[model samples]
Target chain A: MTAIHTGELVDRIGEAVLADPAVVRLDGGPFQTIATYLPGRRVVGVTAADRITVSVVLRLDQPIPAVAAALRERVRRVAGDLPIDVHVNDLESKEEPV
Target chain B: MVTTNSQNDLRDAVPAARQSPAPARLADENGQGKTTIASNVVQKIAGMAAREVSGVHAMGGGMSRAFGAIKERIPGAGTSSTAGVSVEVGEKQAAIDLDMIVEYGASIADLARAVRRNVITAVERMTGLEVIEVNISVEDVHLPDDNGGDEAPEKSRVE
Candidate 1:
């Protein structure tokens, strides 16, 4: 469960999610997702005191609400015992030339 | 209205639309100038792994640009000098202004917080510098792609 190694859970989750074209396609859409997780995380001192790493970006593009709702639903339908956090933000465009 | 370049005519002028803004040199006589440091730090940290946030758009708004141009036009105004960027420095604490462009749909507060956190993390880890604050100015919000959010990673649970 949550106590398992992060790598193992990441592998399991990645494999499971990548195995499905429908789920993988969810990475598209008009929204963005920032998910974090930690295995063997028992609570060190405060929060994130364990070993948690987030995904690159199930990067989406829509507004905050719709994106958050969809990611929450999709994640629940996709994984088991794997703790994932999805942060959806309606930020300005980062594609501009720097 | 006197129509000068027709849209079709303008479209035909593509061979002349080459934009090559000369690489602006960053020169500062002052030690650890705010603008120079902020630009370098922001660009570098954004390229790092821990940030994961979005990107930096611009430093301030139109006023900053106007002032920048004014400085550039004035004598010793330090235009073209990233050092012209404001800074608050002490024996051990420091803060700088940052220009940034975030991806559409990313949270402003969250992105700022992430930038602050990541920048501070980077500064601490790299320079042993304590970043007390980072003032971020978001310039614009881009249009979402028609296929917008569905182009990246997809997370779902399946055996």
Candidate 2:
């Protein structure tokens, strides 16, 4: 098995999350000023350890709990059984009602 | 020593590969090597299955449905049947996640159960893969006035 790098793993987790329609982007929220800034490669909230943590901004239309659960499953698809921590820092207001 | 073999047996009892189901291969006794079913095929199957259920107004969230609408308006862009359906196909099983807008007055619980049943039956019969789960998210409710009542009712000037 090819070894997975932390940066690459972070990238995958980011991609999996951003690809979901419910997830809008990664926002620092209250952690904005405190987070370290990496110019070229920035997965702002992702931290490497035994598992991964993903914090993001999500659209408010979809249910938050469901979106978080889906994100966990999506991350697992790439990271294997590595546990994930998902934080919803902010919510984008719903633009239109169905 | 014997316990280790038993541990392997336990592992085999619930195959780890089932967790992330991949393309399945059926090996026949004949010289033919194998028959593999791609995951995309399963995704499409599940998408179609979900669409077959009644009370499903649409298949995607706000953004994707908006994009789908735009794509449909374009000259040659056809509407996607797989807008809100996502699947992870494992070797012996598959898991599906769907985002949907249900018509108002429909029982969300009953609708979800129906959709799940349809999806599972369709996928299993077609691919011979066990459907581990069908997770449905009711993103929004499509009310009767949603289509035509773009403008809010004018406020009474004399009230």
Tell me the native contact fraction for each prediction: 0.00, 0.00
Candidate 2's TM-score: 0.44
Off by over 4 Å in 2: A1-98, B1-31, B67-79, B149-159
Give the per-residue lDDT of model 2 (tens digit) for B6-57: 3345556766875344543232112211222445556666777888898998
In angstroms, how far off is B61's CA in candidate 1? 1.6
Given candidate 1, what's the lDDT at residue B129? 39
Per-model TM-score, in order, reads 0.31, 0.44
lDDT of 1 by residue, B1-159 (tens): 123223456446546543234221121111111111222333333334223545543344456666777766765343332322455544245576665545677788887788768756654443233567777666655445644663675657785
- Identify the CAPRI category of the predicted complex in candidate 1: incorrect
Strongest candidate by lDDT? 2
